[model samples]
Target: MTTADDFRALHERPEPFLLPNPWDAGTARLLAHLGFPALATTSLGVANVVGRTRATRAEILANVREIAEATPLPVNADLENGFADDPAEAAQMIAEAADAGAVGASIEDHTGDRATPIYEFGLAVDRVRAAVETARQRSVVLTARCENLWLGVNDLSDTIKRLQAFEEAGADVLYAPGLRTLEEIRAVVSSVGKPVNVVMGFADPSITLEQLAEAGVRRISIGAALSRLALKSFVDGAREMLAGRFGFVGELPPITELQQAFD
Candidate 1:
């Protein structure tokens, strides 16, 4: 089966599975070697590595290609806002992402304009529809994201409305990244008939995988959390060194283990 088919099958499993986002090829290979079923590319992670606030389609595709080449696991790309305000351009971006070896991709409703914050509801739905059509032609899994939660619009009712509309627009999976409570997550999953992908960072500590599965989540992704954690270690180690402490090196994985992981 193609990686796209394999990725689609992952959502059909009896329980939800974790899809960790890796920032680079090395991290992708290491995560695959550590036994993750699939991997995702974090746009935030990509932006950070490239020393920019945002990444262009060409940059994202390059990262996607590198990750796909580094591991056997299927790779999903975070195609933020589809890289365009026009539906046709958004659809074209999805096609390009598929060409870069992404088995799955996400298109968010955020417009990238701080003043406007998000696309109007009608336009957002159309954008997702266009992307979904393109993904269908390419056999790539399309994830439609509602950015209300992340865009400072913390309205659950509206978020549900957008997700439902996106589902009708033919999105294979629905996602809203900033949901904080199980009640909110379950409500989204129950309202959308399709598979729901939930972001799993800064979530309620009481919530567990079993709880999420029981609530009907089909996929869980840690977008940029792994990358942030890796950066946290580096920053902390550097700060300690500036304070005359070099103990952070002891926390590093053995050199032999690193070599073996890549081997």
Candidate 2:
């Protein structure tokens, strides 16, 4: 059984773990075949697949259960913002997530607002604390996300300060999604001594995976890059066909690939 213990063990490995986010069963199985130590579900991808704007608590749990049942790899549920307005409600959702077979999960501090993107600091900490307490009962590893960088706060010192508080509040992993610079990443990794998850796709140039590992990043994730890549290919190919560039539509994936995917 791929239990929470298995997910916890990945962190103890010497090299920084790379977990690709998958939305559906096919993607999950492919990731498992790729020998990933674990897999994570992307909320945006799930929402898009289901033709919904966002995920409800019920929908996310159902999806988590489906992905967990489809693969043996430890599955990490991206429980976006905990899916609740109240801390207690969020904690309850975390327990439900564990029941659905999530080995671990993340609770973001983003408010989904452009103007005021992140939650109030104190409330965010309380929310993370609630999630940790709930997950502790099931031994579900809880990751706390600080969205300051993603929201363009761009203050490394403040980001470290918040993450240190999250670590104290019982987060097993500390993540800042938009951190691109080595200095910011190193500072966060150094400040709390907790495993950090950085987004693989970065703007204004980026540090390589090896360099990030040296800089002390313990995990790397490509949030929705795969989905974007797939969409880009489809859109670009259609545009070429419409513009009488049929020859440009070269050989796509083999039929065997699709058959095996469903098989």
Candidate 3:
């Protein structure tokens, strides 16, 4: 098995790669079969699958282990907020995630609020530093995410400042989820010397893989977009059937293919 050290070494390349996030073992294996170099666990997808409002500390670690065992490709855990209220507990959670065979993990600085929510810049940097220190014994890569985009803080300069601090704090990758502008993307890449991970979910994934590479992003992840697409298919199929319309059924993937894939 390739260790996390091996994965970390690959991130130094100038050209970036996409690290698509998958929800389950089957999805992970299929992506590996399709030639993706690595896969990340989607927190929203797993949390929805387990029927939990949000994935708990135990749930996230357990999911990482299960998915890691299912494939040989490197797995990066989307460990939401490190599953802790404080820096100490957050560090412990990062250690546990690394032990579960994760090559990398992401910690976001958002508090799930619409107004006045995110952690102060200093505190957020401390959390990333603590997480990196905890994973020092392991070879896990730590990504520090600033949710200023989602929080409606549209200033790219502020985002760059936060990412710069995270880089100084030992974060291997810096991510800003909702920044779709080329200017902002370029600014972030220039602000942090480490690799950058961008989420490609909006209608038009604004930046292409080539454009992102030129802008200096090292990784791209489609967070929950695939799962949502799958769910939309199910809902559309059901609605068609309820309306006595069988025409849309053929648009779905062949049942045999799904069955054989699982087999």
On TM-score, the candidate that comes out on top is 1
The residue-level lDDT of candidate 3 at 231 comes to: 78
Tell me the number of clashing residue pairs for each predicted model: 0, 0, 0
Query: lDDT (CA) for every model shown?
Result: 0.90, 0.82, 0.82
> lDDT tens digits, residues 1-263, model 3?
35686678668877888788788888887787778888899888888787665777788888899889888888899888876658878778777888898988888888655475688887888888888887666778888999888667877788889999999988888999888777778888887788888788741465688888888888888988898887788788889889989887567678776565455
Instruction: List the candidates ranked by TM-score, beginning with the highest.
Output: 1, 3, 2
Candidate 2 pairs with clashing backbones: none
TM-score of candidate 3 against the unseen true structure: 0.92
What are the runs in model 1 whose C-alpha is more than 4 Å off? none
**Candidate 1 overall lDDT versus native:** 0.90
Q: Pull out the clashing pairs in model 3.
A: none
Which run of 10 residues does model 3 get worst, by summed lDDT?
198-207
